[model samples]
Target: MKLTVHTFASLDGVMQGPGSPEEDPSGGFDRGGWVVPFMEEDFGRVVDSWFARTTELLFGRTTYDLMAGYWPQVTDPDDAVAAVLNGSPKHLVSMTVTAPSWANTVSVIADDVAGRVRELTNRPGGELQVHGSWRLVQALHEAGLVDEYRIIEFPVVVGEGKRIFRDGATASSFDVVETQVLGSGAVYRVLRPTPFTRGAFSVEDGRETVALDV
Candidate 1:
């Protein structure tokens, strides 16, 4: 299975409190819901495509709590995204949450998160997608367990909030597989993480040249 980190972020990479003021206020983020103004059909379409391929979900404790507190209230039967989220198997990474209240929710509190994730991904051909799990994604990134990234960047910037990519994130590289721009001016990208390969740039014959194999 492919482990994918899917999230909606701002131009500055802020992912918290995108839905509403009450959605997330942990960091005293008064500028909540910064990405709401840019919501449009194109954005929905892109999100729909992203969720369509998800077979399972991985989330952080906070994200799970937030989603559990809201998603069950969305009674729209025609809502594909809501249905997927509510129905798919959810794995929450938390030591505090001993029992998950959500119907299909489970917890991964073991110290061997990488091993457990490997056991999960090695099961079959499916996508174990992580959505809005900023904290958990950090650990997964550090462990080099994340495979793909589907990020939708909004034009607005929340000066203070939890960002998708934090300062201490593991240094790595990825190959951008696809990109699109919605009518709301949101830019979406699909990337595959690859090994970090680096080289130096040199001045050759009065021109700068990249020494990729150096």
Candidate 2:
């Protein structure tokens, strides 16, 4: 199983709440529904494609509870996201949540976070997808556990909110696997993490010089 992170973000990288106004008000985020205006068929198509590859899900405590509270009630038979979300097993990372009430869910404490995730990653599967788990994603990222990222970048800028890439995130490089622009101007991007490499260009002694390092 490969660990993949899927998320929706604003142009400025805010990932607090994209669904509803009250979904997350942590930092008094008023632009919670910034991604709503840009939601269209093209965006749905990208999401559907992503869902097709999901085998399981890992989430932060907040994201887990929020999703568990909402997704179960979404009974639309044709809703691809709701379908996959309801069926896939979920692991919630937290120091608190001991007994998860959600079906097919388990609590992963901070001490066991990496160990549990690694166990899942070593399993044979398509993708252990992590969606909207900002804080958990931060820990996984800093631990060098995330293999790829699937993101929907909205056109609006929220200015202030919890970002997917937080301040203490690990320094790593990513290679764009694919990119597609939606009809509503939102862009869907697939990125694979890679070892950081660099190149420097310099003009010395009237000639251009270059140095590359990996």
For residues 49-168, what per-residue lDDT tens digits would candidate 1 score against the true structure?
988998988888899999999888887999998999999988878877887988788655546778888778887868999999898888888888888999999998678788877896
Model 2 clash count equals: 0
Clashing pairs in 2: none
TM-scores of all predicted structures:
0.94, 0.93
RMSD of candidate 2 to the truth, in angstroms, is 1.6
State in Å the error of residue 103, model 1: 0.8
lDDT of 1: 0.86
Off by over 4 Å in 2: 207-209
Cα shift from native, residue 45, model 1 (Å): 0.5
Best candidate, lDDT? 2
In order, the Cα lDDT scores of the candidates are 0.86, 0.87
